[model samples]
Target: MLAKLILRNLLHHWGSTLLSMILLSTGVGIISLLLAVNKQVEDKFNRDLKNIDLVVGAKGSPLQLVLSAVYHLDAPTGNISKEEAEKLLTNPMIEQVTPLAYGDNYDGFRIVGTDSTYLLKYNSSFSRGSMFSNPMEVVAGSNVAKKKELKIGSSFTGTHGLSKDSDDDHEHFKYVVKGILNPTGSVLDNLILTPVESVERVHSERHEHAEHEQHEEGHDEDKTTGKQITALLLTFRSPQAMFSLPRFINESTNMQSASPTLEINRLLGLLGIGMDSVKAVAATLLLVAGLSIFIALYSRLSEKKYELALIRSLGCSRMKLFTLVVSEAILLCLAGFAGGMLLGITGMYWLNEKAADEYSFTLITNNLWNKDQFLLLTGTILIGITAALIPSVKAYRLNISKTLANA
Candidate 1:
């Protein structure tokens, strides 16, 4: 009977009920989106950082080098000689070396010139065809293939520079898609891989007007194109090298240096500030939703004073009367919470699709519920109960004679 009464009352105030539902759902949806993105980005980061012990790159801010080389974002920190990367491979503590060369793009995706070792480190394999075998042959990431609609034999020209609006298009050389990697959901998802020599060949052909010109500053073992690498990925021979090697690479040479684990953690801490603000705002909205429930219930009690008096005059205890009114409070909270979670999940994907339409990049949407989400729901529900307390007390203190006389 109480539930029926509550439903009927809500039906009568359809405008307020609908507004409350929208507000609650919007609050939860925002929090859900935040949680999904934070988890995914962090997961990709830790997975990529696992293999690389020290990153050696050109002389600039070590953080810049890491951002360009490791994360594959932004421009390179200037180029390190292919010779410099080779020397590190000879280190007694070094296990493997993967040199990365930059400065080119096919469409909006970054074209990274790297060797077989880079793919091998991630345990990545082509679902179709094989890795790049020669200069100008390229391997497309899963996202790259889908975005560019590229096939194994498809061809495209790379731009000379990194800018989204570069005029110097490298139409001279054709990059042939040789392979498409299985999706790994890391930085690899949106990249193209090729031989480090390709970076030189394309640019060298462009600047071939300059001739080899006594390449004095940076080259190694007959690097005919005189190309410099953007960075080197070092897998040290043992755990001890994790500490000793990065320092040696930093101090002993002119190159910038980084430990991926430490740097990424710092980056995450910085990102957490933005997430904390979102969570705080979600919490504040939940409080407002609870207050809405309280106000709506309290006003109903005011208009229904004769009804409360009739029930009280029939010998209903103050405690029972209080509980009867508070049940509506519980129903409001639950209805809002369910509506909120439902909108959060569906709306997040819809928003992601909308964002993908604007920016060329697509946000990944395969997220699942976790502890944090449950805790958030619990916290919001607790706030709802706390908000209902004052209205519930007012319901308990009803005087039958006074309320009925006024009615």
Candidate 2:
């Protein structure tokens, strides 16, 4: 009987009740979306940082080196000599080395000149065709192939630089699509992989052509120097190397060494500040929603005083009247939370699709029953209970004689 009365009363004031629900749901949805997106990005970054201990690049900010070499999200600082980078392999503490040669792009996707070891590092394998076997042959990531409509035997010229707007098109040297890589959910999914030799050869040929033109025009022929690589990703053979290697490279050599773990933590720390501010705003919205609930219930209490008194006169106890009001508030809270969660999931799916299409990046969406989400729901429900307390107390203390006479 109490439940039926609570339901009917809520239905009677559906306008204000719905407004309160929408406000509460909007607050819940914003916070939930933030948690989901932040966790997904953090997880993806950690997963992609596997097996690589340090990144060695030309002298510059260590953070920039890591962002460019490991994450492939920033521009390279500069280039170091290939010979200079190979000397690190001579260190007994070093177990593996993968040199990266960057400088060109095909439709906003970086053309990464690396060896088969690069693919092995990410645990990537071909999906359709085989890996690039010779110069002027390249393999595309699954997303690249699908979105760009590229296939085996298709050919395209690369731009001189990483940006898609670069007009210095290397039309003289075209790359044939030799293979497609299965999605690894890593930086590799956004890259065009080829042999380091191919990158060197293309630049070498371009330099030679310029020199030939200079010689024909009665100018001095400019001689090109030794080859350079953008950076080197290395793994340590011993735990001791983790402590000693970065210090040695930073202090002794022209190149700078960056620890992936440290740099990533720093990146996340900076990212957290912005997220925290947004979370604070979401929290404030929740408080406002709670206030709205308080106002709505309090405003309706006067109008319902006579009905509450009649119920008390008939049979309902003061405790039952209190429960009736509290239950209504809780029901609204639950409905709002369910609607908010649905909105959050839908927003995340849309974001995931957009990211996959534009950046070839994947966001983690499989883990929805996370503790943070449950905690938010629990907290929102608690807010509803708290908001209903004063109104419920008023309902319990209603004077049947005075209310009935006034009515």
Candidate 1 residue runs with Cα over 4 Å from true position: 209-225, 311-324, 342-347, 350-363
Best by the lDDT measure: 2
Residues 93-168, candidate 1: write the lDDT tens digits. 8888888888988766788999999998888879777988899999998988988898999999998777557877
In model 1, state the lDDT of residue 84. Answer: 66
- Of the candidates shown, which would achieve the greatest TM-score relative to the real structure? 2
TM-score each candidate: 0.87, 0.91
The pairs that clash in candidate 2 are none
Q: Cα lDDT of all candidates, in order?
A: 0.77, 0.87
